[model samples]
Target: MTDDLDTPVLDNHLHLDPRHGRGIDAVEDFVHLGGTHLLVVNKPSWHLGVEPDEPADFRPVFEETIDAVDAATEVLPGRAWPVLGVHPGLISRLVDERGFEPEAARDLMQGGLEVASEFVADGEALALKSGRPHYEVSDAVWDASNAVTRRAFELGAALDCAVQLHTEATEDLTDLAAVAEEVGLDPATVVKHYAEGRLAGVTPSVMSEKDRLERAAESGEPFLMETDFVDDPEKPGMVLGPKTVPRRVRWLVENGHDEAVRRAHVETPAAVYGIDTEATLE
Candidate 1:
């Protein structure tokens, strides 16, 4: 593959946990491989050693995420931005393991998202991250998770920021788009993280797999690329490695997919996140 470093490569969804992962060192690895930008999302609350009993409890979790972004920025300059919110899987954890009622669990998650919105309002973060669990759950828990997601959409609409989603694997996102429409949020700004292919509705931050990258490149769709690197030291490279995005971009360009590179790495991200990817390069 080509080793050109001119293209602005952005990892749309990534995490840096200093407590349990390589943290800033992992970000350095990504940058060394030609990555240029990142949307550093928050890890789960429990992962940060915080068990939220109220809305304010999420503050520490979000603060840690912002801190990580700050650290990454010091390493990569203005190329990293934070996307904070309550992880939707928290609903199941609250209901099943933490002995919380479904409705109460939903309220807690919504409240946590409200706290996260304040961060976006203060310009500490670029976008909000929220979505339903990617696994099967009881109907009550499912409904509660949807409510929390809708609250996130409302918050995003008010802040005029994108909402990165983490949900079940699906090619069709029409139903989720409907939810965003009902909440009066732009469906185009709702990014599907870990997306495998061209989703029917909403923006797709396609995961950096060789086949998926090739398909997204061949389709010529306006999409973004991400590694979704968990950065967990225990399970290193569990989701995808941090270097995957830039490496995939090189592969695409060498395979005569320059247009896809421009769109995925620059155009689409600028359109969705309202940030100049090229500016960071200069």
Candidate 2:
């Protein structure tokens, strides 16, 4: 499986939780199946047992993500870049578990994003991650989550990097694109993680399922491919497996979707994240 393809196979969103999951071994699974690159995203702070009272508290979470990226780069066949930020669902935790007001929760998330942005600025990470809750929430909490997402967009604009979003599953992402535009960030650089298909205005990091991959590939528009591999030991392959993207890329190629492979794995990621996918593959 690893010998047939010459083009880069990049997974746009993945997580590595060494304390609780397969960690670098999961990354090895990806590379062994022919994946050439990864955008290793940060898990939620609470997942890492970090309770943030202020911005500086997010450092350890971001550092953990960076460390995972470094470890993957050190031992894996492909490259791994860090994407760090506050998980949108953290707003719910802050309000419900931490006893923070909605507005205060939003502020703390924004501050956490600020710290994540500094990592991008310092070249420790490639992009910033942010989004609203994927489940039902109070209107105020939803508003706060959006505010935090907007702050992420602002930071992405300042750093000239990509922003990976983890929002509710939706077919239309025109509203998210509008927010990116309002924040002076290019909508093309706003990636909808766990995306099902090609969105109208925003970049879709389509999940590597046959149906979704077929739909996005058939669209012929620039898009990215991801597994959203949570890498949790208990749930083991909760969202998707690490080898899914590379395997899907092979499927696309066999189905004569070479252009889609180039667009999703090479062109789109390079344009959005400013990484030389071809060079990295070499």
Candidate 3:
């Protein structure tokens, strides 16, 4: 393939789970394919079905995520960043005492993310004492998560690294913006890929994407477009064919949407990942 993405070609979302072909093979492939850095996200212990009922027993997922990133950075030299978090897939658990009822969290086994709290303590606290888990957005939870995001952002700033996040629902994106702002993060600091499925209420490819794109444009926040994943045709999707970015870049050269596209796919991500915009995509 062409080194079109060689400019930075960073994939923020990747897994270490062997079942999804995520382990070393995945890392090797990404490096081979020109991924300068990968944000490796990890999960909590409960998902493996072996854990203490106590929140105190579980470690913050970020700890492991950081470890993974550190290891990758050492091994890859200039590739692999760690994205730390618990997915909101556990909305039920946090909001209801009946949270972990049989089959309640079973959905997590399949790419679920609602479990990890930005604040490991909060998620664990809720997990242990949440009398009535409510899936609806909780200010307390958001606040706690915001704090954790800030810590992570500050950590990134210290190392000049990018922070990967779980951006699912409209609320999730809202949280992302809030946390980014709270952490004094430039929109470009967030590296998101395949993070859509989080928003349950917002139907895919619906009216939200236009709003997202418009927001990205207005804020000069560059977002990403990944290929090979599902997209909601109703929205503006970033996933382009291997040729999509080039074609779109060519199209923009020959058409409009250049300013917006440049900000979203190029400027934003490049700035966040510390890549040179003029470095040449290939």
Candidate 4:
């Protein structure tokens, strides 16, 4: 991601995962290359290094991170746009990953994310006295946790922000799609990673990911791509997806799927995340 590259890039989904530092340098490199703004995604509390003992203090610290990300915007091309904070995986994907009691993996994974604090607020606890709780954890915790996330998304969106999310299960990408619609995406602004339904239904023949990207052309939902590019031959346990996204991009460019690729970032995602830019090179 250098400034010298003529290709326009929109990094719609980079984790400001606090496990990582402020991405100021990376942001500058992209911007210098004539890249436009990024849609900064928030890390879920579970992803924060905070331990369980300090669980209760979680939401405030979550707030602080958003503040920090917002501050970075002042130095960006424009004030950087933010995604309201929440890890959709907190309730589903993360929980399953943690080896929690194998809850029914529905449209999304279940069990929810780890928390830094136990729920203590009385009124906040009251909201979930009934059924169908939305909190990633128990009913008692849902109120406050849900509030923090809602507020983060609200503030970010009000600022014309875009939300970045990780789907809980591999097949849950469509659910993320549904969530984007619910968030009132304006187009091209919504972003989901590891999308393209490569992992839609794990099997033997679904092995060729590039083939899957070609198949996904019909659905036309937009996506973003990134690479930690981790390839460990010893860890065949890891997903095979790392090889796919960039290949898909080049494939799009080669096969005139650039319009399809561009739609995922600029138009469809922009509308979903409320982005004002076209995500194209000027």
What TM-score number comes out for model 4?
0.48
- Can you write out model 1's per-residue Cα lDDT over 1-282, one digit (the tens) per residue? 223567888899989998788998998888888878899999988888889999999999899888888888888734789999998889878998899999999999999999999999999989999999999899998999888899999999988999999999998888988988888889999999999768888999999998888888888778899888888878884989888888888888889999999999879988898999888764
Native-to-model Cα distance after best TM-score fit, residue 78 in candidate 1, in Å: 4.7
Error of 3 at 118 (Å): 12
Best of the two (2, 4) by TM-score:
2
Candidate 4 ranges with C-alpha deviation above 4 Å: 1-8, 17-22, 32-34, 46-56, 71-79, 88-165, 172-192, 197-221, 224-251, 279-282
RMSD of each: 1.4, 1.1, 9.8, 9.9
The digit string of per-residue lDDT tens for model 3 on 1-282 reads 334532444343444543222345445545554444444555434453334344333344444545555555554425554444444444435435545533333323211222333323242211110111124445654444444445554544444455554433343454455555565655345544443323221111111233343444444334553332112233224343222333333333344555755554446546655544334322
Backbone-clash count (model 3)? 28
| Candidate 2 C-alpha lDDT tens digits along 141-170 | 999998898999999998999999999989
Collision count for each candidate, in order: 0, 0, 28, 28
- Residue 170, model 4, lDDT: 49
Give TM-scores for every candidate, taking all chains together and pairing residue i with residue i: 0.97, 0.97, 0.47, 0.48
Residue range 90-202, candidate 4, lDDT tens digits = 43343335433322221121111112111112111100000122334554334333443333333334444443334333444343334334555322333435444443321
Using TM-score as the yardstick, the better of models 1 and 3 is 1
Question: What lDDT is obtained when candidate 4 is compared to the true structure?
Answer: 0.39
Give me the overall lDDT of model 1: 0.88
True-structure lDDT of candidate 3: 0.40
Specify the highest-lDDT model's number. 2
- How many residue-pair clashes does candidate 4 contain? 28
